[model samples]
Target chain A: MQQVIQANLKDNDNIEPVFSHFETQLNGERSSAWHQKRKAALEELKSLTYPTTKNEEWKYTNIAKVLANDYAFNAPSDLTKEEISKFSLSELEAHKLVFVNGIFREEFSDYSSEKGLHILSLKAAYQAHADLIEAHFSEIASTKEEPFTALSTAFAFNGVFILAEKSAVASKPIFILNITDTSDYPVIAQPRNLVIARENSEVTVIEDFVSVGGKPAFLNYVSEFKVEQSAKVDHYKLQNKGDNNFYIGTTQVHQSDKSNYNNTVATLGGGLIRNNLNILLDGEYCEAFMNGLYMLKDKDHVDNHTMVDHLKPNSYSNEMYKGIMDGHSTGVFNGKIYVRQYAQKTNAFQENKNILLSENATVDTKPQLEIWADDVKCSHGATTGALDEEPLFYLRSRGIGEDKARALLMNAFAEDVISRIKSETFKSHIETLISNRLENR
Target chain B: MLEIKNLHASVEDKKILNGISLKVNAGEVHAIMGPNGSGKSTLASVLAGKEDFEVEEGEALYNGQDLLDMSPEDRAREGIFLAFQYPVEIPGVSNTNFLKTAINEIRKYKGEEPLDAVAFLKKMKEKMKLVNIDQSLMSRSLNEGFSGGEKKRNEIFHMAMLEPKLAILDETDSGLDIDALRIVANGVNALKSPDNATIVVTHYQRLLDYIVPDFVHVLYKGRIVKSGTKELALELEDKGYDWIKKEVEEGVI
Candidate 1:
């Protein structure tokens, strides 16, 4: 249990390797010790096979489009700080880590270091706190089964590393802005991150993926979170990329006894987006929640896969994801809950619901529960259908037009999850983004 | 004012309203009484342009315009309001916000500007008195967690705000206690004006004691077989409607 789990790589014939552009990286670390670790991650990546629709977990998502086009590597570009101002949430005063083209830009980044609050980029943190980063960096999130995670690990240089010490929280939330702006050719950016929350500490992280130009940018990202005993963490990932961008992300969390983990993934804009999230209840009396909402239009595609493993007894997990699909878009959700043999008295619930707005739009969701313990309670359900016409008719009968009626009904449907958010500032921010997206469609 | 001629309709290819014809003028209250499955509510639904019902052959004129040709929202905007028998509960939508949106949409249809927030709240406060509605109830989601009586009262409150020229109360008196019945009837009476009309559909004569009707018609099967004044309600209550069924069975209309 103290060592990292190992995974061997085998090549599959269906997936064509389009990652030759990532043969080298621009990591600023000159330390010889860290260079050897990066080299080994890339060597492991070469032996692994990429997943395709033929795989059971990737059946609904076809990666032909991603493999068809050629993507360039991270190219050095001259973009002023004002250029990325459009993607910054300036309204919220907090720590900012700006990564442009997968390299940390110090001029556009700023942070306030409160008590026990340590926030810096992975590159800078490795330079200053090498021992702390080496001890915890790849210790939990392994590059074994997921080749994409291995690839990101090989080239990760400009992501965020956050730590909230015992009972210490930053004055505000931390914003990690990963902007991909490569105007010449299609490029790729890998931003790897790690978060550590000490005992009884609480912090929130907002990680955003955005693009500015017409280049077909590909984002291969990985993030690891370690929540110690009695600590709380709220993590949000907002994926709003360009129409030609592709995003593949993996997030791993290790929770201790009496710790709490809340994770939400909101995919507002992306051509092809996939999220793989894994949470492990490493101690008893722990709780974890996973809630996601994806709003897709214009032939886009989004897929979410989550797994929660209970390693100890008396733990709880609740997972729910909803999708609103319009145009010819597609969505996929697969949730799995694993209760170990000795994890008795475990409570786990999972639900996935999708509303298809058009006949051509589609969704495939599977919520599964695997329990080895006899005294545990677990339930899973999945539903995908078009919007109910009765509510549409009722609203129209009250003098609201058909378009506005549809928008209001969708908003109400989203409210079931949006209401769970505690911050009015954050809730209204997402509400306005979603409303504007629906109205323009 | 409204007029119907040979109105026939069906739901899911099953005939419901067969050849119903009636006339209602301004300043008049007409009550249509019938037993269960007698098509009284069907007639009201057809008048309100519910799309679930397919009009086989019918013509309805509201102010000399073809009422059957309008959409449900357009019909509502053109001064034709039908209080639903079972109101729909919409979660996450506040009652006050729904009312405001409805009022503004209806006003926009008539080429009028929307009311400001202050003006809108002022008007809402005045009409809320008609039902004696609590201010707290206005902030909650529409009809969510509401009692049956509260839902019925909210319907009447909506009627008071819309002020339609032709208001159809379909089964509004059902599932109400005597107190709630009196309050709802009083709300209707307070909203009445010389330029508007109402058509009440019910199964019992108990509600008639509160909302007095100028004319009462007996609907058997799908057609109106008999017509009389308010005194007819007493007769129907006295005879228990069996006599009318027997008369209709013998073709003695």
Candidate 2:
């Protein structure tokens, strides 16, 4: 482990300039209550080191390929209408916020809601509502051990800030688009977003990362969400970057009493992708559902690490993640559910299932449960298997060809998770996408 | 039409079907009644081109073509269907969609265009009526959480949709209750036509009472030891398989 860390540190010089520039930017800003916290986070990041394969959480996922690459920190850049339009969610016509290279592109954004909903860029929010932004940012995410979270805090740029006032329910969901264009050079962009749903408020946020062209880029992103008592919030993180790009993202959510938080992270495309999601249940009677679907082919690698902490009694958490791996692709799913001693009567269920299409395809799944409360009902299961040949033969015996039968079975394996999606349109869209991917194969 | 000449097959180096010979013409129903471990299911599996069973000797001809030479999908495309003893449960794939894909794949193999959704649904409604399958069953995932009777009915439903020339019912009456047995038999009887053939494999004579066979062959020790008309099934039911084994032991017909 020491040798690996030494090797990683030797290569860290390439990214040192980005960290230096981040420190300069932070020191240049005016002092505030949140400034000390940000400074402390930066100091933690400087003290800690990047993770390697020796780390148990990242054993199967190789992050060395990313640290070895020389990538410059990207600032705000001018994006044309044509480039921004490509990132729009045509299926969703709600309020949209477009960010080019991790910076807010206001000309391409639309927040036409007249309700008590505040949607602004992080920079704008820092100037306009510094108190709220300062109180919530980096508060939900742990910056001490996570190097990526520390880096995101140190080089935080223009990310969307959304605030739903007390008792306000926004009819439409807020969409945040993060577009990357690394055609000119290899670059890294860290976008930090903070979403606060006040007491009894309701809102939905959709965060998307898309690439304009087939460029080799790196995206390090972190978003913190705080839900007050009796609030309901739904979030979706979609990573559809180009095949040549790498993406590392973390979504930290904190739920208060009687609040509900639902998150769905879909990783469909990326050269190498790692998603770390943490949901903390701080209040009683709160419910959280974390569902994810990852479809990978070729040599792509996708890793998902999710932790659901049950801190209060009467809170429930359900997590289900499914992956379809083909070719030489690999997928890793590590899901942990922790039930505290006081979290009695808690109901938690977790399941991770993966299907390997090719002989070379692999999947590593670990569904873990740490329960200190004996009264809680908790169960976790993980399964990694190839397509059932008998089922395939049963379908073929009915005149369905082998290929079509395999595809049907594969799609069916993923449909259980896809159908659980609350939005019908989103479910159907994902269904179509999976079908097209199978068809192309 | 189907013809088997000295067919021999094995699984994992264990011989199952040894020097079996049989023949069936179009518009004929052949019943294979055998005792336990008599290779009744093995014959069905071998004919359907299951990959696990290796054919070490002999040849099978379906419609004057080499049946054993084609892949399982190709054999299915050539109008050979097998109703499994234990139907597989495919979760999340609707019955209607599964049947549609099967029908379209077979049609494509025969150089025909895929059916439109409306046309497929129209045909599916008719087939559902034949099997007495409910419309709700068609919308649910294929065979997922279905009762034993419903699984058998769905098999017949698939047979009706594919319209195979030769249908092999492998112990289709194993798990059915009296009423379900009657319904499954009735569905099979209704689907019978002059252009297609049926091969029924059963351990009891109860199913033969409903879907009467033109011929009944007793498979013992992986070979047909006796062959006769519908009366043979009745005789076996009365005297039991031990009587047949005695005859074989005594070298009598």
Candidate 3:
């Protein structure tokens, strides 16, 4: 493991420049309290090493090719209006914040909301709301345990920050679009986000990572969320980077007393993608739901690692992740539920299911539960299988051809997961995308 | 029309259908009553081209075509339908969608244009009435959470929608109550036409009371031991299979 880490560091062309750029930005006068925290975080990041397959959490996902690539780091590039328009979501009246190459693009953002909500770029938020930013930035994400979280903090330049004050309800969702256009050379971009929802607040956030041009690029992002007592928040992360892009993202969330947090991560396009989602249920009566749907084709690879920690008593968490792998693609799902000693009466359930279309397609799923409390109700299960032949025959016998029947069954398998999306338009859009993928096959 | 000559099938080298022979013309409903382990379901599965059962020596003819040579989907396209003894539950596929795909697939086989959404719904509504299936059930997943009687009714509903030339009901009455049995039988009886035939495979005589068969055959072990009219079903129900076993032992079957 140490040899792999040393080799990755020796071939590190993508991340050094970004670290230097962040250092250059910090040379100016620093008034925010988070500045000191950022300095400490960067020092902590420099001492840690990147993770490898030898690590238990990353056993099934290999990041050797990703660390070997030489990528440009956080270079400023002008984006046209046409390119930014491509990131618009259909049928959503949202406050859009666009980031180009991980730097906040103010000219293309709209932050006008009638509700008492603040959605600002991270740089601007750090300057404007230093106290709130200092209190929660990188609070939930542990730099010691995760190498990617440490790296993200070491080069935190610009990202989106959302704040919902006490008793405030943000009727419209806030959309964060991270666009990468690296046509000149391979580049790396680190986008770090922070979300804080105070007591009795309700909000929904959508974070989209997109690679605009068909260029070889890498995106490493970390998002930290803090949900206060009795608050409700729904978060969605959509990673549809270009086929030549590699992405490693970490989402860390902390839930308080009687709070509810729901998150959905969708990975549709990427050469090699790894997503780590961590939720800490720090208070009693807190409920968290983490759901994910990944569809891969060609030679793409997608890996999802999720952990839900039940720290207090009487908390509940449910997670379901489904993957459909076709062509020569591969997918991995590792979900763990942990019930601490004090977390009595914790009800946690996790299920992972995958469907392989081709004989060469592969999936590795491990659903685990570690319960210290005897009274906790916890269960986890994982299954990997081909399409059911009986259902295929039932459809074919109806006079549907074999191809169409297979497509229908495949679509139904994906639709079961897609229907869990709360937004109807989002659900339908995903349904259309899944249908197209199945039909094309 | 369908014909099976010297039909012998086995699974894992264990012979199930040993030289079984049967024939049925269109516009006739033939009932195959048998004791347990009589290879009744095996015959149905073999006719539908299930891959597990190996046909050691047999020829299944459907409309003068070699049925065994066709794939299951091809056999289905050739107007061969089998209402499964236990309809497989597909958790996320709607019944209406499944039926529409089947209908269009058969249409494609016949070189016909696919039905538009409006026309398909119109036809589905008509068939739903014939089978006494609720409209709500059509929108749910196929046979998911359905009761035994509902599954049988769904089979009849599918048979009505597909309108195959030959239909095989493999123990459709196994788990149904008296009222459900009557409803399912009535649905099948209503779908009878001169262009299509029905094969009702069952172990009991109660189902025949509703939809009386033109011919009844008793299968013992791997082959049919007796063939007669509706009176034969009554006699078998009265005397039971012990009499048939005794007759076979005495060389009087």
Candidate 4:
């Protein structure tokens, strides 16, 4: 064990620039209490090695290609509305926070503030909403266990901050648009976010990662949420980047008593993408729902790691993730459900289903459940198969063409996960994107 | 409309259809009665171009073209329909969507324009009445969670929409109740014309009572041993299959 840890530490030499960038190049509030935390976080990040397939959590994904690139931190750029307008779901009147690179863009954002909802940039929120920022920022989502979260914490610059007041409900959805236009050299971005829904509050927040100009860029993002008692939060992460982009994102949620945390993650772009979704049901009677879909083609690699931690009694969690892999692409899903000893009568279910549409396409899925509570009802299932032949032959036996038949079956398989979303607008938005992806495949 | 000569086929080296010869012109209804493991369904599956069966040696001519050379979809477009014994359940594709796509695809293969949604639904409503299918079932996923009777009725509904030149009912009456059986037979009788033919494969003569056949052939051990009029069905029904089995064993036709 000692030798393994030592060897892993040795691999950190490849990520030397990451540490040096935080120490010498990072330009944020230098004198604030959070800056000292960032400095300590950078030093902590230096002791660990880069994650690789040897690690149990990353066995099916290889980070050699992403780590081998010469990635450097880039300064923020002012983005025009026309340049980023293609990605905005302009039909909805909601709270908007637009970010380019890692800096918040305020000119292209607006929301009605009549419903006791607070929105601000993380850097500005540190000075304005100091109590809320200090209470929840980095409080729930830890960087100790995850190397990507450690990197994002060490180099945190700019992101969004949202807080829904006690018993308050947002009039509409909240859109956090994170756009990257790496028209020049390859760049790396690190953004940190904090979201808090106070007691009995209800809110919907959508985070979009869009890449313009097909540039080669890397985005490492960490967003943390603290849902208070009886609160309801619907969180979405939509990753649509350029073909050469690399993205590693993590969204961590901490729920209070009787609170609800619902998450839907859709990854439709990027060459190498990994998303870590961790929901910690810390209070009794809390509920969590996770639904995800990843459509990969053309040698792209996507890995989704999800965990629903039931720490208290009477908590319930349901997770379902579906993937469609075509061409020579690869997909990986590792879902874990952990029930603590005190979490009696907890009901947790996790399922991951994948379809490999081509001979070269591949999928690796591991659905795991670790329960210390004897009274818990936990079930985990994983299915990986080629498209069913009976249904395909049945479709082609009619006059439908082979390509259309395959696409139809693939879409149907995807809908098993997509249909679970409760929001109609988001459902149709994801439906259209997934429809185009499946048809193109 | 269809002719097969010396059709010998197998699945994984197990020969099923052995030297089967048959001919049927348009407007004729032929009933094939057989015992179990007699390659009755194999003949139907081979006609539909299912990939599992290997045609060892045979010549099946449909409309002066080689039926075996075309794909399943191409054969359906060329006016060949098989009402499957066990219709597959597709949980996401609606029956209406499948039928519309099938009708439009077959139309495209015939060098004709695809019908708009209104025209397509109009035709669908017309055929729905012919098959006694409800609009609610048409909107649901195709045959998913449907009863056996509903699936058979759905197959006939598909046949009504396609209007094939040769419609092969492979035990379409296997799992249907008396009412479902009547509805299916009524739909077949309504869709029949002088330009289309029907071949009914069955193990019992009960279905033959409703959809009367012009000729009845007894298929024993992959070979047709007897051919007679509709009275042959009644005789076989009364005597049971052992009489035919004993005659075939003794080499007496």
Candidate 5:
């Protein structure tokens, strides 16, 4: 395990080729504002260095090994719906947008028609609704400090773009299905997504990341959500990729007055995965709920970093994340709650709990709350330990085997976050995934 | 149905039960009364095969099978149930789901088909009446935020569901009120049949009033110093355990 310290993606030979491929996919939008944003993002990415363990933010998660591979940029796949039938949620009736190797495939995508609701690929939206794209694109997901966010912005030609117009309620959810086919060569897919829920509007988005091939694949995803005044948005990210894939994603949310935003990300499997979820409570009386569940085994590693910033008065936010690790896996949770001086009467709560089933499995959790407002209330806690011996024996004394008892306990640990899911279909789907993973491990 | 010969056990290398022998037959109820730290609960735990307790030298034969050699789950699947003194709270695991998993696993062990949802619900409905447990409590997290009386009642409900051949009630009346004790004792009495047996291990003789025992044994320093009929329980209750302790100390029992 050598720490090569791959400080800058700018020095890698793969960057130029990947940028050139991204430019070719732009389809002659060189004069557009989006192209200029990409150019500016590339320049910003060169100045930013890849994070190392020495950096406090990445102290526990060392991603140098995942980034050491030489990924191919020219990855092209023509996978059909039948090939990816295994990953489909049959009960989920929503608008389906499919992407392969970060390239939108219109033939495999279908959308539901609804008045005042606009859904398109980022590239298509730049062409049809350039004004909207120009206004929201790159506004919240800044690339100045984060190299991965910069990389995603530099190659943001293909992804999902959704806009819910004023007072428009989406009839159903919008499912963005991203699949990676690395059977040909090791590849990388950087997809940028933007979601806007206008004033008094509501929308739900499900991002399902899956991979088909065994070769090494990397998915760098960045999504921005703008929840306007009195609007509601529910976001779910299901990361169930192959064993040979790596994932790093950033979800940045901006909230307005009286808005509500709820997010749940379940990372069941992957070689290495990292998630950065940040929500800004910039308006008064906003509400945010963040829930996450990650179960890892067999050398899998996952790191989740979440931040909630309350800048206005009378806002509330609550976050709870739980993890189950076994078989030499690693899990990290870093949550920060910041209440500004003016954010009086704010209430924020954060908790992270983990269960390590094996001696080799490990977890590092840190919950930090910084409050400048004297009238605000904030609390944070983290706990990491083995399953309770009393409960384990209680289940076994009633005829459950040792393995089944452990699995039941693990499932019970995950239900805290799973119960927060509002969609029954999605909740059952997640429960199945979590239980299957727990049993197999 | 259950036989124990010179049972000796210890936890963490500290001796608890030392050289004790007892036998319980089908259709019989045996009550063991003892003072605090007199190895009453240790005997029940050892018979139930709690892993923390190591059997130093003993043989527990349940239906002529070596119960001490079997795992706790196997012992349970083989119709041996121990009602714990303190049931642990398992958050997020509903009482119904926990019972279902336990029942199905026991059924699979006995080469029987697992119960379906409809059958399970019906059985649960019937068993709830045995202990007067509410339907809402079954759907909530197991034993979480439950009152002392409610937890005890739920234990009886679980016992009714499992229907074990040998039921070991360990301090089942410790935290129960008078009404709760009556309901729980009635549940146990209703579940008793000619094909099964019961071992009531208690510190106080009050529980025996409702679910009367056929035989009473006084355990002093891990060995039965006295054995008699139901009248022995009344004597111990009226006279207290100091006389029994004095007899054991003076070798006059």
Candidate 6:
């Protein structure tokens, strides 16, 4: 046991203090069932070490340096409306919920006025809808196995809680903006979010992650979504955490019979970023779509791990993720598809393409498929290369400068994924963000 | 407007152009007729400043400026256009947007203001008639999934838009049907003026019937072995390039 602790965690003594400080803050909630789960997750976290490159799951991404730094768990922020407005998408007409440093700020949030839709902070949901919170929390995303999920389950106190009842359709999309303020000092924020779409309900959720200050910060975010029978859920995650931040995100999804789930995540900026997306098609005739794009530059690194498990028959899952890396940055893509024994007639397709602009820029991609079913149609492909010289030359010979030509090709490579986004305003917003980043690359 | 003086070029240390020279002035079209693997496309690419071909010896003077010294885009901004034999398909970049960017960048390089969106669209609509290009095709990705004839016609459309002083058409008539060839040639003829020149490099003399050249040169073994009037193209078409190959091998005029 002692050797196992030494193998997993670099400094056991540092974690002991962090956990105790968090436990002391849970004064009234110490006796709640949720706190008990948090305690159990904390124990599980103690045994799990920060992953090194030696681990198969962490092969290309090394989190040792990120773990070596000490940061404030409950970071304080003095964010004003003006400061918050800088990151706001004024063009989007969606219900907004803002979180600062893992804590929900009601003053800055606007709730949806539609009926049968409930959006609340985790604490408010705990008081108003205890049964729903207890039934779904940590159920879709088990915290006992994954290190970051367990860390988020243990330390996170506040996050967004959304529920859509039967046949309820959100008139407008819900935008959850998670802002980590590191203006004063280095910080670590863990936000646990849960979304439940009941039978025949539909909703679109946009999760935007950004940081204001230049200080080194760590954001451990976990979100679990349950798509009930015949329900539909569209999820979008856009991350631009600037130069001095490290982010680890986990998104777990469970789909019911005939449910539809669509997710699109774009990571444009971060010092080091890792995202884990897991989906379980538990019922027949369910469909899932995952589209992602990441454009990294400088020394920034982004790793995306995605898993889709077809547990029942006649399910469909498709994934397309494209990346463009410039400077000395690196990227990793590991996509897995699983078909159970009884999950016959499953159709799964996965493709990942990458473009390395600079000689030093690199990418590692792996597609894993485990099939126990006989009648499954599954295809996966991965491609990594520099920008096509033919297109570059073609553009340049037309009076477009070399830099502009490269940017044009890079943007075109990313458009397929961006075009999949349904919202015109949001799509154009993402287009602006990506085109601006590719302008001087 | 274009002068080549014993220009020598190679790709990957293998000589392709061995001391080829030609001279063209404004208001005139020159037809370069070559057999397969005779370095016809290589000459076109070298003039457009393709990086794969290294200019080993000699020089190409475009309006008295060393063409080899400029980058491909700089050469383009200076009114040198090469209509590719195989136009590349760039998905997600609309043809209109690409042409607009190219025009603005060239204008920027020439110390001129860019055309506004309204003005640019007006120009595009006017030029669309030159090649009979449909308006809907201009909104699609640049030449992606375009037919062989459509791609060739697009090259002419681009030529009309850029309005180059020296246009090098490298096998632009290849894989083109007769009607498509006529439309492309007509667009080229429509864009010709006393201030600009055209160099048509082709394997067949079929395209010359539409846009007749002032001079026809037979290129064999990396050098222009014969130079004649437009009637030379008809003579070559009737006798085939084997005669020219035999003439070159025998050192006969």
TM-score of each: 0.93, 0.94, 0.94, 0.93, 0.95, 0.96
What value of lDDT does candidate 4 attain over all alpha carbons? 0.84
Label model 6 with its docking quality class.
Answer: high
C-alpha RMSD in Å of predicted model 3 compared with the true structure: 3.6
Q: Residue A12 of candidate 3: its Cα lDDT?
A: 32
lDDT for model 5 comes to: 0.88
Candidate 6 total steric clashes: 2
How far residue B224's Cα lies from its native spot in candidate 4, in Å, is 2.3
Error of 6 at B34 (Å): 1.3
Judge candidate 4 at residue A56 and give its lDDT. Answer: 91
**How many angstroms is residue A28 displaced in model 1 relative to the true structure, after the best TM-score fit?**
9.9
lDDT of 1 by residue, A221-312 (tens): 88999999999998888887766888888899999999999998888878899899999999999999999999888888999999999989
Error of 1 at A75 (Å): 1.9
Alpha carbon lDDT at A282, candidate 2: 94
Of the candidates shown, which would achieve the greatest lDDT relative to the real structure?
A: 6
Q: Which stretches of candidate 4 lie over 4 Å from their true place?
A: A1-29, A76-79, A112-114
Instruction: Give residue A200's error in model 2 in angstroms.
Output: 3.5
* Per-residue lDDT of model 6, residues A1-441, tens digit only: 111111113564566667776777677878888888888888888788777899899999988767766677666788997889777787899999898877788888877547999988887888888888778898889876688888888776799888999999999889989998888767787778899999999999999999988788888899999999999999999998787889998999999999999999999989899999999999999999999999998999999999999999999999999999989989999999999999999999999999988899999999999999999999999999988999999999999999999989988999989998887888899999988988855
Candidate 6 colliding pairs: A8-A49, B1-B25
**Residue B230 shift from truth in candidate 3, angstroms:** 2.0
- Going through the candidates in order, what is chain B's TM-score? 0.98, 0.98, 0.98, 0.98, 0.98, 0.99
Candidate 2 structure quality by residue, lDDT tens digits, B42-121: 99999998899999999999989999999888999999999999999988889988887888888898899999999998
Residue-level error in angstroms, candidate 2, position A30: 1.9
- In candidate 1, list every pair of residues with a backbone clash: A72-A186
Candidate 5 lDDT, A168-187, residue by residue in tens: 99988998988889877677
| Candidate 5 TM-score to native | 0.95
Inter-residue clash pairs, candidate 3: A72-A186, A72-A187, A398-B102, A399-B102, A399-B105, A399-B106, A400-B101, A400-B102
Across B8-116, the per-residue lDDT of candidate 3 in tens digits comes to: 9999999899888889999999999999999999999899878889999979899999999998888888988999998989988888878887888788888999999
**lDDT by residue for model 2 (A1-441), tens:** 111111122243434654555545555564666667766776777778788899998899887777765554653344688767756867776788887766677888887644778888888788889888777788888897988898787667578888889988988888888888776545577788899999999998888888865446778889899998999998887776667778888999999999999988888878899999999999999999999889888888999999999999999999999888888888999999999999999999998988888899899888889999889989989888887889998888787777788888888887777776666666676788788887778
Candidates' C-alpha lDDT: 0.83, 0.85, 0.83, 0.84, 0.88, 0.90
